[model samples]
Target: MSPLLAADEPSNLPDLEILRAEVGSAWSAYQDTKYTRATRLIPGILADAQRAVRSYEGDAQLQAKALLAMAYQGAAMVLTKIGEADLAWMAADRGLGAAQESGDRVVTGSLFRSVAHCLLSNGRLTAARDLVTDSAGYLEDGLPDASPTYVSVYGTLFLVGAVAAARLDDRATVRAFLAEADAAAQRLGQDANHMWTAFGPTNAAIHRISAAMELGDVQVAADQGPRVDSSTLPLERRVRHTLEVARAYSAQNRTDEALALVLDAEELAPEQVRYHFISRHLVTAWVRQQKGKPSHQLAGVAQRLRIVG
Candidate 1:
């Protein structure tokens, strides 16, 4: 149960071969701004993956729970990144439920870390902090210190810490946690081929850019994000990365570039990909609003934003 697979619902009930193909194609399409095609297939994939866990007949509680928890975590990521707060939280809750059922402390730690992430994405920073602290206790409970999974859990905890600090406008704390996350992630470099790290590098960097922007360092984020290659990222990735870039531009008073990037992203992605819609739209609107103030205002705009899980 790779946690990465939990992000999107594939649209069909294909076998492993077919499902993998579907996810691969979807990832490619998503990166290329083919949301109309991508969204059409994601939900089913997610549903099928979630359903598969129900049939896990394994005797090992740790393995089963870890697998199931990853499923929920994946689902939560897809929903939250796409701005579907309700569904994202539900998915997180479901992951927590699975972890509780298996009683695997390590998986339980993962669950708390993930659910806290979902909450942080939904603007529940205090709740996220408490949960991350709770996860720390689970991490301390005989968990192997050197497992990639353990390192990943600590990375998640630092991410939550970064978000909490971001919410409070605590620049020092934000940098500290974010740096810790990067370092934990780097520690896993020994297993760069580890499946856990395939997307970890890109994903963690994205969050780092987010936290950097939150800490009022768009210049640093802009300089840093070039490494993410937005054009080469999938639909969800590009949409998000584009927004971050736009924010960086806006922060630097590069209004023309910011507005242009906003429009470009809007034109590239579809409304059905609400993950791209609401998340990027707010940033676009804010940037446009900022540009228009004190002399001129952004004009000819109508926004359609849907709040979902």
Candidate 2:
């Protein structure tokens, strides 16, 4: 085992419910865009989850493994956001192992998404798409009697697959993936955070905007991005959608609109804007394009993103 996953010295077993709550709290911090807090909470969560897994048996052990999988998933996500691609991959791999052991198909599917995300971060676009495809296919066989969690994870896989296809400039594949996601969302019937996947109709629409942006369909992105209501989604998803629309506006040279949207995103989640490569890249480009001193708003955002420093 990697030192990162090494079991701690034997100690009192953690309460399963408490350990689960801690894992949920870490995910909450992450979705709130409290990256530093989430990062701080994860290692402890993982250690406790590991301890719980070691101390439990039968169903309890399985449940502990599920929590361990979730904790690792959270770690992978935060690490990915902060540019720790290698560590993110490790966390994702570990999460997958735990999920398989837990026999939780939803957790397993979700971990597949995490691994695909790590692949995407590493620029392995085809690998990411193939992983999503294979995993979603395996999970699809359960759709006849799928629970909400299963549907959510299954749908979300296609959403990420859409992104991978978009990045590869495979418009047909992107469309196919998005269509699958939309169908799943429609079956789901409403917005939900099932298994921490904000997979629903609105979220599917947001992914459409993301896919459009990735495929360089600036017109499609610009036209649809701002119109979607992401208020019902998680704070993280809402802020990310705002950033995508801001990027669309920027692409159209609607500088004032783009700047306004970015500032709006900053208001929603300052840390998200500060940590996001897209926001930083946009601010950097805007600063460089200015003939003289940039506007106060732009300058302020630049400073917050540390692009001016």
Candidate 3:
């Protein structure tokens, strides 16, 4: 068992609200790119959530299970970010179990998305695509008058599926998945972070940029990636999209532009840039290609990323 899954006996059990707030805080830490803080908080949150599950019963028990699911999902995301793919899979699987027990369709769907993410991280592109599609289909049938949370998770699933399809170079499937996500965004009518999904039209557009990048349409990604104002999205989303745009620029040999974007992202979220594979990869390549000595800015960013002295 992962240390993250290990539970400690609490002297006093925290109520559902407390657990929810802790989970929310951990998520906020993650979005703010404070990965270390997020990881530190998660184990305790998981332990407390487990205690809640053991102590509560009836509806309270179900709610506790939901919190556990969210906690585990957060763990998975953090683990994935830190390049712990195996542990992430374990966390995601545990979250799925908890989500099922919670009997919350939205939570279940969200966990399904997390599981697909784990698959994607592990290079199981086909499995990830199939899982997202199947989960989206299952959720769609049950959501007659869907809540915002339901719509967000349902749509986000297709967005993830689009990414998986893009990686497979399946243009048709990618377009179909994006269209489904866009339709869901239109139904929701605005950008909302329901259940922490951050799903909306802007997010759909961001996914299109991602798909373009995955499909090796560097020009399209470079053109469209920068124009979309992702300011309305979460900090994490904004930083990630910025990195993607930087990648597009790099692919086009727009080294200066790419370096500038990388710098900008680093300023916004230093931890994210330091830990992100794209930023590290780009910096490493720049350092390797330098003639005698790299530029001041390049050296500075490279040093910060620990890729140079």
The candidates, ranked best first by lDDT, are 3, 2, 1
Task: Provide the RMSD of all predictions against the true structure, rounded to 1 decimal.
Answer: 7.0, 2.0, 1.9
Model 1 Cα lDDT, one tens digit per residue, 247-285 = 788778786777677666667664423345434455445
**Model 3 alpha-carbon drift over 4 Å, by segment:** 1-11
Q: Which candidate model has the greater TM-score, 1 or 2?
A: 2
Model 1 regions lying over 4 Å from their true place: 1-66, 103-107, 140-145, 190-205, 222-239, 263-274, 277-309
Error of 1 at 50 (Å): 7.3
Candidate 2: regions farther than 4 A off = 1-11
User: For each candidate, what TM-score against the reference?
Assistant: 0.66, 0.96, 0.96
lDDT by residue (9-92, candidate 3, tens digit) is: 455766789899999998888888899999889988988888888888899999999999999999898888888999999999
Which digits, one per residue and each the tens of the lDDT, describe model 2 over residues 164-271? 999999999998999999999999999999878988999999999999999899999999887899999999999999999989989999989999989998998998
Total clashes, candidate 3?
A: 0
Error of 2 at 264 (Å): 1.0
What TM-score would you give candidate 3 relative to the actual structure?
0.96
Q: Which 10 residues in a row give candidate 2 its minimum summed lDDT? A: 1-10
